[model samples]
Target: MAAARESLLDAAGAALARRPWPAVRMVEVAAAAGVSRQTLYNEFGGKDGLARALVRRAADGYLAGVERALAGNGGDWERLTAVAEWTAAAAQEDALVRALLTGCWSERLPAPPRGPAPVPAQRRPEPPLPSPPDLVRIVRDRAVTALSGPGTAPAATVELARSCELVVRLALSCVTAPPGEGGIAGLIRTAAPRTAL
Candidate 1:
């Protein structure tokens, strides 16, 4: 069932890439996924449900990348640079990620649902896609938790959070108006405060 769900989602995502979500057909998605239409419905409930799941999955995937960048070996600022770089790059490569981060959902992409679908398969409803500000807060909090070494002072933690948010916001800026020569890392280096995250 999990495999079918993933395949269906992948198919839906691919179909979305080719055309607008409204134009993507259940039959084609099921065929592309090698699952029956009924199986697709069972996994996602319907197109709206699938859109919600897609947005949720994109958020999860982006956050997972942030975690990896934060967890990997690096100096304090380097870890944040990695996260910022990933943010810009992911938004460039994935329309869903870009839309979620920028709140500029073009007609080509799916507008996230208002709320969760009452799908039995969902068990628990997936959280709505984070707004851009929500995403900033989420990323800032994650960076603080990951980078705040044991027993850091609260004041220091607050300062570190500020640094982290600076990096994230700079990355967001890069997503909207790309940097000129040195790319996002250069932008971060120039714009980031003397303190590092």
Candidate 2:
């Protein structure tokens, strides 16, 4: 079952890579994966479910990249800098990541009409909103684990977490920025630690 789920996800990603999200249909995905539509439905409920899974998978991959960057052999400050650069590069390079960041195709589908809806009014309390990623938590955990060697300072840990938040925001901004403007590298340089020499 897990193998089938993974195969469906892989097929969906491949289809997404070839074209925009609107072009990706469940029938095509099932055919690509050599599975029935029922199997895809069972694994991922529907298109929205698949999209959420894709976004979650992309988030996990991005966090892993951040972890690798934070593991570089350097002081906490340098590791944080590396993480900023790596995150910017990853967001800029990945198509799936770009889609997630930019919200492409997400606005095309209108919300279901409210009139004569299937459920009774009493039973239809507002659905819970999806929470944004806990990027700060992820980064802080990675920084603490990677930089907690003998000489690491407590202040440095806080600084790394602060820097991670700034860097991640800047990376996301770059993804959504206009094409002609300078990129996150400029933002990172502006926010870079000052040297006292």
Deviation (Å) of 116 in candidate 1 = 3.1
* Every candidate's CA RMSD: 1.3, 6.8
For residues 85-123, what per-residue lDDT tens digits would candidate 1 score against the true structure? 999999999999999999998888887667556675655
Candidate 1: which stretches are off by over 4 Å? none
Q: Which model scores highest in TM-score? A: 1
Q: Candidate 1, clashing residue pairs?
A: none
Per-residue lDDT for 68-147 in model 2, tens only? 88777876666766776666577677765554444453333212122332332323323322223545466656765775
CA lDDT for candidate 2: 0.63
Clash pairs of candidate 2? none
lDDT score, candidate 1: 0.88
